[model samples]
Target: MSFKQPLKAGAVIATLDVGSSKIACFIAQMTDDEGGFEIVGVGHQASQGVKSGIIIDINLAESAIAHSVHAAEKMASRVIKGYPLRDVVLAVPATSSESHFVDAHVQMMRQNVTENDVRRALAKAQVKAQKEDREIVHTIPVDYVLDGHRGIQNPYGMSGQLMDIDIHMLDADFAHLKHISQCTEQNHLDIVSLCSSPYAAGLSTLVDDEIELGSIVIDMGAGVTSYAVFQSGRLLFAGGVPVGGQHITSDIAHGLTTSLADAERLKTLYGSALATISDEHEYIDVPMVGEQNARGEQHVTRALLINIIQARLEEIFEMVRQGLEDSGVEASICRRVVLTGGASLMPSIPELAQKILGKQVRCAQTLKVKGLPDATSGPAFAVSMGLISYYTQRPYEMPMEIASYGESKSFAERFKGWFKENW
Candidate 1:
């Protein structure tokens, strides 16, 4: 089952991000052999098919996916006809994803820690992950504890009768994965892998040192904010808040009596999460729908708009703080918080997040790529770039699918094929 042969040079792969606010498509070719990769095609479009971080209407989702992918293909001077681009590495938000830690102990059957022992321990951990009414999406091995020796990175080639493992498994609600699968399948695409949004963002933005020591990656999307804690190159905590940039837009629309579209444009061009009366002298031209006043009502001061957006942004970060606290991971460990996604572009968002999270925060930007537009290299492209980087590096583990024959049935087998639906 191993793809041992060297992949062809200039092998092109595609990544699709069906985000809350936008659907982004990326196509890149492997370069410099296996060490470096380069981008060749990219496309993005405003999403009308999704809402609240999940795909609700399959038809709309399919159209949106096709639009983004086609544009990228055109840019690459290629056409992915039919199901040529079926397999892909997909990213999903944490709103519907769940995670838990499981510990397993195996006797090793009078032998040292062997491959079978590792499999058995993983089986126990998987069973524990499915104890609740959810389906397992990912099973990650954190560390192994063999006999009295703890923190053993590899238990194999060591003499120990008792094999113990600490596993970090994630599960998503059945309905959530099914809807996503349907949306992609209807569009003639097959999800080869389902990646956590935070993990996907971390793939490109996080460096080796940051992951080894500790860092928090916060992916701020339109309708949801996803966070991940990485220590020793493993995902320690993952979760998301139900609120995001959409909330800020809603607040501005309510406070200023403007349409949602106008509020969004204002937020992108002039809104800041931190407001100061000293900076209130500047005024912005607001599009008026046949409304005018001698007091200059059509033009509004920037401070008022900032004040409204700031309130919502503050609440969202507070909820993120609460989520970190609830995960039992000390906030002190995350001295560096990297902000990515569309909402991270706000002028003073990094400063605002640092003030609230008590950590050094900065916007996440893409790196080491060519043929990409300047606008696509900013913090907003972190997830899209990460998706590309993920396919290039192939870092994450794939889900183990049960074989048809000669496969031992474990307690975790009950959830196999659970996600299949006609849709």
Candidate 2:
């Protein structure tokens, strides 16, 4: 099927991020200025039926999605009895996403490069990137080589006999994506586009300097921590580790013998990745598990809580380090590390990340998007805000119907035919 038409100026666009810990929705209107959009409404609810960034119960997921959407609609002052939200940009997890590099070349017809030539090269690369059970989510042209000269960003007006392009393609499990689509459809929402979690996070947190100089964005979410590498203003690699903030909470609950709710409260109030000298003297009240009243409350030193939190966070960063190495992009991630998400709010996380990841680390919230409320401007909302930014940027390819060229035709001949037919 052909892709949906791009949003017009002043058109309302909604984005939904079905994260492992929370389901968030944002409604915004596109502006006339390029890369300019404003948030009009926002809604979020505690995530249920989702674990490690994947949906486990469709019914519960659907309800949570519906609730968040309705809340956003109400805030926007736009409500409908039937299908109020028709289209929404969705964010998918990077748990099973894979990246593949493909190269394609086209022979010039009149010694001048054209958009058609780029499209043909991209189509060829796309064809080669196909897998048996996976679907392509992103196809980004990283660099262009023309006549042996490399690093060409705009080769449209350049002259070259052979145009070679290196494309980075991201693919994910088809069944997992299909299930996500099903859950959205249950709420009468049409999937406008599916963006990877890491890609969205990078878009939201990375600045122009970081993108140009190369950097890594770590989205430390509740149930999963995902990272993506950006170089030359494009995403180069994306990966995720299943461990996240929720795991630490679980560990605290288990170690302290408390309820999950109380453990979460304690983690948010006093959690730290590194213990200080004063932690031993600081005392906190802990409600023992299966306790009926205040009699079951226990006092534990802050040192004990920090120990549990620190152990889990250290393991998470270690896994992140290994995942980056396994991705083979460790060398490219040289500029700095930017951490976002609810878990990143921990006081000592940036310090721990710098010590373990061996780079300068900074905890970042979402960049300033106009009309975004202060309440929703933290790291926890990075993915959702990034979805809006992605919609405004519209970095993906536009779906087009191409005319078929005969098998006997050469590359130049097919390029001419496709170019004439389309443009």
Candidate 3:
């Protein structure tokens, strides 16, 4: 899909972040100040009928979407008159998608390059992206090559005999996208665009220097953990693991024989990924799954909880480490890592990530946007806020039909044919 349209000035923008554990909606408006985004409404509900980035029950998903959007719309209506929320930018989960790099070169007719020449190069890469069973989510430009220069940022006006482009393409399962689309459409909201969770987290959490100088964003949601690499202010890599905080909660629940709700509460209030000897001295309450009396509750050392949490977190970070190794980016550029998303809120997650990923890790919040509450200033709202911020930037790609059908395409490639049909 083409991200050619940008957020309009003084226009109201809505965002929906659908996840395994929670669904959140934000109704915001663009202000006169450049890059200003003021929130008019907000709503969130415990997500149902979605697991690991796939829709399991359309009715439940639609109901959840409706609840979140309507709550935000009601709040927004109180703030602005005559403007009803009708469209939203959705955050696509990276767990249900695949990210790959495509390189294509165009021989420049003239030594001086033009924008058309750059388009031609990207178009060649797009042709390789077509497949019937999958749909393109984001086609991001990673780096440009001028002749043999490997890291040229842009070759728009430069002189080069050959222009090579490295583009990052994210394709999601076509059926999965259709189900999500149906849920949102059922809620009377139009999905204007879809931004991957990793890109959204990076956009909302990373600073200017981190984006340009190179940084990795690890977004730990309830049901999925996604990581993105950014360099020169562009997305270089993105991938995800199905295991997330929810899995940790399940571990706590199963090991302690407690309810899922109680398990979540414990994880939220007292979970830690870095256990210490001192934790054994501290005690917390654990309620049994089916308890009627005080006898159902038991005392457990914090160390026990920490142990369970740490084990799952270690596994998560190990997977992230492996993903980064396979993501095609070099170790030198993976020096800085930023932790975001709701699951990243767990204590010592960054510490554990640093230890496991062997990179400098820090927790970050929503940056470069305005009018967010203190609660949303953390990493949890990174995706929703980034969905709102997506309008401030310009991204170019082909139309929504960036696919070639009626053939045996393996769930996934075709940008070259689009160029011929369009230009």
Q: What is the lDDT, from 0 to 100, of the residue 119 in candidate 1?
A: 67
Return the lDDT, model 3, position 404.
28
On residues 1-423, what C-alpha lDDT tens digit does candidate 2 reach at each position?
Answer: 122335666777788988888999998876765556678778899898898988898789889988998888887764323326657887878886777777889887767897777766776665565565776667677889999999897788799999998877777786676677777777767766667887888888888899878889999998899998888777888889888999999999999999999999999999899999999999999999999899999999999999999999999999988988888764445759999989999988999999899988998855688878788899989898888777667444421211122122243243233323322
lDDT of 3 by residue, 59-100 (tens): 999899889888888888887886767677878798878888
Preferred candidate (TM-score higher): 1 or 3: 3
Please report, as a residue range, the 10-residue window in candidate 3 with the lowest summed lDDT: 399-408
Instruction: Arrange candidates by lDDT, descending.
Output: 2, 3, 1
Q: List per-candidate RMSD values in Å.
A: 3.6, 5.7, 4.9
Candidate 1 vs candidate 2: the TM-score winner is: 2
- Model 3 TM-score is 0.89
lDDT of 1 by residue, 1-423 (tens): 121222357666677788888888877766766646667778788886687678788788878888887777777664323325545667777888876877878887656666666766666556555645566666667788887788887677688888778777777776776776776666566565566788788877888888888899999889889998888777777899878888898888788877788788888888998987765898987654335544434678999889898888888889998999998765577688989888888889999999889998878866557777786787666777777665555433334431111133553244434433442
Q: Which residue pairs show backbone clashes in model 1?
A: none
